[model samples]
Target chain A: MSLSARRIIPGLGLFVLMTVVAVWALWPTGGKVTINDRARDLAAELRCPDCEGLNVADSTTTSARSIRKDLLRRLKAGEDEAEIKNSYANRYGESILLNPDGGGLGILVWGLPVLLLVLGGVGITIAIMSRSRSTRLTPTESDREEVKKARGK
Target chain B: MKYSARWIALSVGAVVVGLGVVLAMQVGNDPRIDATKSQLVGQPAPELSLRALDGTAVDTNTLLGKAVIVNFWNSWCIPCRNELPALKEFANRYRDDPGVALVGIVRDDSTRAIKAYVKAEGIDWVIVTDPDSRAALDFATRGQPETFALDANGLITGAQIGPTTLRDLESLLGSAQGR
Candidate 1:
């Protein structure tokens, strides 16, 4: 209802909106997860050992084809996503997954960027808040006396 | 705009993070290679049964109590061709050694092509045809010229990728406790 209140509300709304946009844009991107796409999606995370820089989902090599077939079979057998992934990892080690694991040294690879982004956001918000506070008008002694006189009248 | 310490810190952090990622990608990274050898080693070799070109049944169970060397190859693979001579020689040297067994599983090729290559190379060892490549897949074979060395207990003791040599086979067989 007050003038300052209205301005502050819109500014807060804008800050929140910008944050949501940044997170949505910078967060990890993955395809839609569905039963039909499950096998293919997991396959995309596996690299073809026979081919250079090719994922199993995109490779026609025998190794890739065999892995894809096994993945599909496991999926149909009602295996959990992590179970299927670990199956390959058990055989191949952590490197089998296209995405690094969230634990161990792999945590650094997946976490550093997110941590930096959040830190950057917090830093920017602090800088902006401090700048705004410094520039805003502060009530002087004369201004306070004028306010008191107005209140008395 | 002046570059602040915040920006410099972020830049340094980013470079470090980038370097970490690049280094991580290079470490233990062999996407093309499945964990077959690592996982299968110390575990029993998967069950396999295939008929040779002569229509004789070759079963893994029968080959127990002897060190089994299962070599997966295809006629189309150049490395497979190159490794054939060494394999034949190894088989010949160990022909009288009942403790050693060398078996070749032909993959992804027609019986005719496999038989012709076997006869031309005089492989002489147990050459079996893997009709649908089911056996090779069971062994987690990535491509041609991958050989698996199994101990007398049927446990996989060694896995060699690429074109293998006589020395490779010797080393594998040498470390095999069964031998």
Candidate 2:
């Protein structure tokens, strides 16, 4: 084999191995989805009606326990998750869900942080790149004079 | 500063200030549930088939022509105790009126304690036990002392949280339509 091909082959193999490992690690498990698992997952997203700042899964309040049990029963009865969640949101208010709806005012609540993060990242990158460029500029006559004066002092 | 750095700083500052202003505007954002604005309002009250303390089967499905006042309370709650007099007065006022119905569901309390309290307080209204807190869950109650008034059509007309005064109860009853 050619020297360039020999050098590139191991790096390509390593990259392919990394890509496979990453895909396998990030892929969701294909295990059986049980009613209990669905119920618990939904419960984690629902707010506890009687408690302060606690979701149904974490709260030990009677209302939380009752809701969790009700979720399991609903799931077992072949009701879809959206049907159950909508029923809850209808009975209670929209605040019952830990995460707000994706539409309407929920868009602002979920989108603002990400937008701000991107803007901030762009600003930082620009600042850093410009700083590097500025540092590379050669010293002018005035700059040398100032440096000499400082050195003399 | 370089031109790019200055622009970046200005934009960042502007965004930070904008975010601050937006957040500052929400300083008065109330997280607590609004008492006057229950989601159940204008919706039919959930069907009830619960057992009362005195072995009476209190089924709301049977009370079609009467307005229902479902009050969720517990003996341990101070607000529940505070609102007892208003409720008792309401029960006395509506004793002979078949057009109205009052049902008090116990929340997170024992039957023994409720029975004792009912006996001592002379609570003649339909006092029911919420097994597994089913009624509370059905009603979507936040806590004790939350009351809901349903009109004769089984539509929830008014809902109130916290200790309610006699005047408040009267206003709630007045709001119930379709009677």
lDDT of 2 by residue, B1-179 (tens): 46766776787788778778877887877544542357788888888888989787988676677877889999889999999999999989999999888889998899999999999998999999988899899988888888988888788889887888888887778877442
Model 1, residue B150: distance off in Å is: 0.9
Categorize the docking of model 1.
incorrect
Candidate 2 segments whose C-alpha is farther than 4 A from its true place: A1-33, A120-153, B1-11, B33-37, B177-179
A21-134: candidate 1 lDDT, tens digit per residue: 999999977776666588898899976755667898998876677778888888889997899888777666666678878986677778777877776776676665565556
Model 1, residue A47: C-alpha shift (Å) = 1.3
For each candidate, report its DockQ versus the true two-chain complex: 0.21, 0.39
Q: Looking at model 2 chain A, which ten-residue stretch has the lowest summed lDDT? A: A128-137
Write one digit per residue (lDDT tens) for candidate 1, span B67-176. 87888888899999898778878898999999888898886788898888777877788889875566776776656788888898888898887888999988778756
lDDT at B46 for candidate 1? 85
Query: What is candidate 1's TM-score for chain A?
Result: 0.69
Residue B11 miss distance in model 2 (angstroms): 4.6
- The prediction achieving the highest DockQ against the true structure is 2
User: What is residue A25's positional error in candidate 1, in angstroms?
Assistant: 7.9
Report how far residue B179 has shifted in candidate 2, in Å: 9.2
